[model samples]
Structures are given as structure tokens and as C-alpha cells.
Target chain A: MGFFTKLLETSRVKSPWIVHFDCGSCNGCDIEILACLTPIYDVERFGILNIGNPKHADILIVSGTVNHRNAKVLRNVYDQMPEPRAVIAIGACGTSGGIFREAYNVVGGVDKVIPVDVYVPGCPAKPEAIIDGVVLALGKLKEQRTAKDTDSLAAELHQAREFYANRADRQVVE
Target chain B: MSTIIPFGPQHPVLPEPLHLKITLKDEIVTDAIPMLGYVHRGLETLVSIKDLDQMVQVVERVCGICSCIHAHTYCMCVEGILGIEIPKRAEFLRIIWSELHRMHSHLLWLGLLADAFGMESLFMHCWRIRERVMDVMEATAGNRVIISINKVGGVRRDLSPDQLRWIAQVLDELERELDAIKPVLTNDYTVKKRTVGVGVLTKEQAYELGAVGPTLRGSGVAQDVRMTGYGAYKFIDFEPVVEKDGDSYARTMVRFRELYQAIDIVRQLIRKLPDGELSVKVKAAKPEGEIVCRSEQPRGELLYYVKGNGSKFLERVRIRTPTFANVPPLLAMLPGIEMADVPVVALSIDPCISCTER
Candidate 1:
């Protein structure tokens, strides 16, 4: 492996930039997520930056239940992130669809669309649990970036790059 | 030419997904239309499947910030329909939890507003104080955010004298910290620059647009549903915090003053802590009636309507949250304001989209 790739892999575990997306949650999990950034819970000490843009993020932190309408949006966000990205499903709704699982127009957990690496379970998961979940995601992120994982990783990146290139080509043709 | 700029569904200023379509004429906003339903979990419709007791848990999840009050108001509605009177001690406990919820909600709003205008230290300071309230909540009720203390007839838990004393001590410390930071919030140059003379909603406009809570109180209307005397509020003596300016600054002041009001109310409830049974044993008999219940939530007045047939499950449950009522005024206030001030102006109403769309 190249020295730069190894450097990037190790640095990712130390500092993981994450984008938080609320699919269809009661603001409970969302607030708890925000609380983690505040002075008391302050997840920043671990170098976890709450980056707003999905493209700039290394970890995707999703909260709440995924509804039918937002399912596409969630997929688009996941697709926008570069390969080796990890997803942390925070709160019960994001993990297995807590209380609103049976509701009409609800698509259950976030795993319905994208791959989730870590699951933090709570009605609205506490900030402590959320931080722990992110730390867990960082471990998965490091594993995904390892030399042994690159074979399957290269295949997924090839397909994603092709999909983007085809879409760009289509736009130019139009 | 007027161009449209869409904000949110995932903006930093908003915790929940609230989309705003702003039509701007150069630097000024010509019109603003808010589109909701991003966080709608269809909780109200779950009444058909979950029984009335289980539905409290569902209702509590409608908005996590105001979970205690949502459960409190829903239980009040069911109790009203059943005509069951709760014990005196439970009423006092309910008031204590509700006021604590109000303190944390206001502090959360204050911190967010500070963060919106780029006041990082002020945001940190506010949340620091807010943590104290959350600690008291955790020490007493077990959870930090959703206390889940409110039950059908009364409350699920009780506090000992020592715990109550610890709460009073913590509240005293909170008040001292708030005093140190009060000037920064009220008289700071940046806070004043962003909030003062912005988003002015006249009394008539606020009334016509159906604004409620601090949004209504900020407009000089002095209209608080707490004056209606539900729960233990009838026993406590208090008045709504009103500011006549009707600007963003005025709304901010209304919430700022309310933080102290909540503290005072909690103090009063603790002092007059009554002695009795915690909750009356409610029969699991199916309810048959239509009832409307109202309670003063931290954001504003929450109105809950429950229709029950002779079944364990309720037929219908509808909630009209304060944010839903306050959004129209936000739309009215958006135009004629600079594009840069839109976030603070929208936040001035303390919009909670989860509750609004629930």
C-alpha cells in the first residue's frame, strides 16, 4: 500500500468527520445527537467534526425511522460519500424502527436503504451512547480502509465511478 | 427580479427538517413559504393499534424535547374523559417535571439562537447551564431528555426530601450561573445586532396569524394558556412573561424571562409540595367520549383531542402544537427582512417541526 493511503487510514480513526441525517425521527434522537456536541458531552474532544455536507464526511450518522419519501434522499447522501465511509445508525428508530415501525408511510430502520455499521439503541439514544456509536463506526471505517479490504472496495468504487461518469455523460448528451 | 432560495430539510440552524422556500428580491426577502412533513412519523394514527396506556409512550416520542408535557397533556385528556381526580402530590410532581422541561427547552433554544448568529462561547455557556437542568432531571426521573414520569392519573415516580433538596440546590446554582451570563444574552452587541428590531410582528398580525406561546407573548398580547389553570398551575400564582416590542429581540426577551419564571414556578411547587397518594388506581375500562385537553408546553400551548369508543384503543388522537400555530406568523414576518437574518427570524418562534408535523 502507498504511504499516503496508510496515513489516511490511520488518521481516519483519530479524526472522523460525520454528517448527521434525520430521516423521519421524533426530534428526540436529533436533539440527543446535538447534545453530544455541547459542552457537557462534547464529542469534539475525539476529533469528530459535525460536517454538514455529505460529500465531505467520512462517517454517515443517521437517526430516526426512514420513510418512503426520504429513502431516496438517504440513498443519495450515502452514494455521494466516497468509498470507505461508515454509517452509524443512532436511536431505536434508525436501528429497528422503535415505536413507529408499524405506521403507514414509514420504511422502518435506515438499514432498509444503506449499510449500517453500528447501531445505538434508545427511544432517543443518549449522547453518551451516540458518542460510543461513532467511536464504533471509526473502527469499521479503519477496517474498510485496510489493504486486505481493498479488493472488494476497488470493485464497489469502480461501479460507483462508472455510475457517476454515465450520469455526467447523459447530462452532456442532453 | 426575485429569485427563490430553499433553506433546510437539513440545515444546521434547524434540528428537525423544516424546508423554507424564500423568494428574495436582491438582498431582501419578498416572500417565504414553509414546507413541513419531513419528520412526520404518523404517531397520531398509531392510536388504532396501541392502547391508550401504550399510546402515551408513542405520544411522548412525537417531539423528544417536549416528551414530558406531551405525555402529561395526553394523560390529562384521558383523565378528564374518565372524570378521575389525581392526588395532590402527583399534581405537584407533574408541575415540577413540566417546569424543568420548560427550563431545558428554553435553554436549548437560547443556545441554538446564539449558535445561529456565530456566538460560539455564548452557545457553550447556555448549554452548560442547561446541563444542570438535565442532571436534575436525570437524578430525579432517570433519563436526561424524556422523563416519562407522567402517567394516566398521576405520575410514575416520586422524589424524596433529600432528592428534592438536591434539586433546589442545583436550581440555586443554575440561577447563579444564569445571572453571570444574563448580560451577554440580553445586552451583547452581536446578539442585539442580530435580534433587535428584526422580524417585528404587530399585535394584530400575531393575532390574525394565530401565533401562540412566547411568539404571542412577545407581541404584547399576554395570552398564555397556563392562565387557564390546568394541573397544579391553578394552585401557583404567576403571570405570562410579555414584551411589547414584538421584534425578534422581544421574543428572545420573552424566552429569557421565562427561564426565570420556570425556575420560580418549580421553586413554588417544591415549597408547596403536597402530601397524598401518588396516583389513583384507574380502572382499565374502555373510555367512550370526545375530549379536548390543553396544557402550556415550554414552546407554547399544546391542544390535544382524543376520541375514545368502548375499546382499549382510542379512535382518534389529534395534537395542534404551538409551532404549527406559530409558523403562519413566521411566514408573515419573513418578507421585508434581509436574507442574512432569515435563520434567526425563523428561530425566534422556536420552531419544533417534529411536533408541528406530528
Candidate 2:
């Protein structure tokens, strides 16, 4: 790999900019996620910045459950982010839909619509846990960037395609 | 020429998902229509599956910022239907937790409002003070945001004397820190410039529009549901914070002043906390009637309606949150404002879309 490419890979882990999207959260996880940016947790000390633009983000941190209306928006956001991006599913709602799973308009977890690299599980998911989840996601992001060979890229595409195909079949059956 | 612009489903200033279809005529807002359902988890409909006791946890998730109040109001509704009175100590404890929640929520709003106006340092300072409240919550209730302590007959947890003393110490520090930032919030030139006279809602307009909480109180109306003497509010001296200007500044001041008021209420509740059981053992008597319960959340008045049919599961559970009432006033405040000031005016209502949609 070129020296410039190696520097880019190292910087992705060194300072990962994250964009948070609230799919259908109770605001508990959303606030906790916000708390990570505050003085107490201070996730920025790790060079992590929470920006709003998905295109400028290296990690997509999503909270709450994925509902019907926001599912499309969530996919749109994920699609907008440049490649080698990582997604962290936050809280009980984002990981497995928590208590609101039985609701009619609910679409369960974030993985129902897009891929997730790390899962942070808590009713609200404390700020510490959220920070840890983001850190873990950065590692996955580094691995993703490194494993960009043709064979690995093709494998990831096939896995993602199969995952969506199975989801479509499940939806049809349901 | 007029053009309609969609102002979010994902905006940096908004902490929750709220979309406003704003119509602009030469940089001035002519009209604004709100679009919701982005965060609707259909929590109210879960009454069919979860039992009455189990519903408390579900109700708490309606809005994470005001989770305790939602659960407290729901429990109050169920208790009213069942004709069960909670213990005095539990009532006081509930008051303490509710006020703590209020303080943190207001601080969170202040930070968000500051962030909205691009005052990043003030935003950080507000949240810095707020961490003390979250720590107290974690130390006492075992959770930061959603401290699920409320139950049907009473509360699930109890506060020890030492814990009470620690909370008092934190409140003292909180007040000191609040005073430090008081001038910047109330008298700072930039804050007033952005907020003052930006979104003026008349007293009549606020009342007629059914605006509740700070939105209504900010408009010179002294209508607070807490005055009806629900929970331990009757046992303690309390007054609603009001501002007459009815602008974004007025609403901001109302919430800002409420932080001090909440600290005072918590102090009073701690002093008068009665020694009794945390919760009563509720019998197998199922609630068999419809009842409405109301409480003052940080945003404003929260109302819960519960119906029971002599079964484990409730017949229906409905919640009318303060944000739901504040939206019309928000729409009213949006017209005639500059496009640049939309974030400040929109955030003044402290819109909780999850609660509004749920």
C-alpha cells in the first residue's frame, strides 16, 4: 500500500468523526449519546467529533428502534457515508427493539435495514458504554479499510446481499 | 415568491427527530407546518400486551428526559383508579426524583439552546453542571437518564439519610455553578439579541392554543398543573415560574428560572421526608375504572389517562405530553421570523418529538 493510504488508515482510527441518527429512540439513548460529548465522558479527548453531515462522518452511531418511516431515511444516511464507514447500534431499542419491539410500526433493530458493527446494550445505554461501543467500531472500521482487496470486498458484498435477501423473504412470510 | 423548505428529520440543533416544513418569503417565515411520526414507537398501544404493573416501565420510555414523571403520572392514574394511597415517604421521594429530573432536563435544554445559537462554550458549561444531577441519579436510582423508580402503589427504591445528605451537597454545588453562569444566560448581549422578541406569543394566543408548561407559562399565564396539589407538591410550598414577554427569551428564562425552583423544591422535600415504607403491598384488586392523573414535568404539565377492566392488563393508557400542547404555539411563533432564527425559535419550545408522537 502507498504511504498516503497507510496514513489515511491510521487517521481513520486516530480520529473517527461520528454522525448520530435517532431512528426511533426514547431519547434516553439519544441523551446518553449526547452525554458522551459532554465534559464528563468527553469522547472528543479521543479525537472523536460528532458532526451532523453523514457524508463527512467515518462512523454512523444510531440509537432507538428502526420504524417504517425512518427505515428509508436510515438507509439513505448509511448510503451517503463514504466507504470504510462503521455503524454502531446503540441501546436496547437499536440492538433488539427493547420494549417497543411489539409495536405495530416498529422495525426491530438497526440491522433490520442496515449493517451494524458494534452493539451497545442498555435500556438507555450509559455514556461510558456508548463511548466503548464507538471505540470498538473504530477498530472494525480500520479492519474494513485494510481488507479492501478484491476477494474480501466481493465477499462483503455477497454477505450484505444475502443478508438483505433473507430479510426480504422473512418480511414476505410475516 | 414563497418557497417551502424542510427543516429536519435530522438537524444538528435538534436532539430528537422533528421535521418542520417551513415556507419562506424573502428570508422571512410566512408559515410553518410540523411533520412527526419519525420516532413513534407506539408505546401506548403496548397496554394490550404488558400488564398494568409492567406498563410503568413502558410508560417511562415515552420521553427519556421526563421518564420518571411519565411513570409517576401513570402510577398515579392507576392508584387513583384503585383508590390506593401511596406512602408519605414514597410521595416525598417521588417529588425529589421528579425535581432532579426537572433540573437535568432544563440544563439539557439550556445547553441545546446555547448550541442552537452557536454558543458552544455555554453549551458545554450547562451540560457540565448537569452531570452532577446525572451522578446523583446514578448513585441513588442506579440509572442516569431513565431512573425507573416509580411504581403503581409507591416507589421501588428508598433514599437513605446519607444519600439525602449527599444530594443536598450536590444541590448546593449546582446552585453555585448556576449562579456562575446566570449572567451569561440572562444578561449576556448575544443571548438576548438572538432570543429577545424573536417569537412573541400573546397571553391569549398561548391559552387559546392550549400551550402548556414553559411555552404557556412564558406567555404570562400562571397555569401550572402542579398547583392542583398532586403528589407531595401539596405537602411542600411551590410556585410556577412565569415570564410575561412570551418570546423565545421569555421561554428560555422560564426554563432557566425553573432550574432554581426545582432545586428549592428538592430541598423542601428532603427536609420534610416522612419515615415510612417505600411502597405498599397492593392487593389483587384490579383497577376497574377510568381516571386521569397530571403532574408537572420540566417542559410543562403531563397528563395520563388510564382505564382498567378488572384484569391484569389495562383497558387503555393514554398520555398527553406537554410538547404535544406546545407545538401549536411553536408554529405560531415561527411565522415572520428570519430563516436563520428558526433553530432558536423552534428549540425554545423544547420539542420532545418522541413524546409528541408516542
Instruction: Judging by DockQ against the true structure, name the best candidate.
Output: 1
Model 2: residue B84 alpha-carbon error in angstroms: 0.4
lDDT of each residue in A1-174, candidate 2, tens digit only: 699988988888999999999999989999898888988889999999999998799999999999999998799788777778999999999999999999998999999999889999999998889888988998899788755677755676676577556743112111
Could you list the iRMS of every candidate?
Answer: 5.0, 9.5
Clashing pairs in 2: B213-B300
What tens digits encode model 2's per-residue C-alpha lDDT throughout B122-211? 999999999999999999999999999998889999999999999999999999999999999778998999999999999999999999
Point to the candidate with the largest lDDT: 2
lDDT of 1 at A98: 89
Per-candidate clashes come to 0, 1
Q: Which stretches of candidate 1 lie over 4 Å from their true place?
A: A147-174
lDDT of all predictions: 0.88, 0.90
Candidate 1 residues A1-174, lDDT tens each?
689877887788889998988888877788788888888989899898887888789999899888876787688789878767999998889998888999987888998899999999987788889888988888888777754466776886787788777753112111
**Interface RMSD, candidate 1?**
5.0
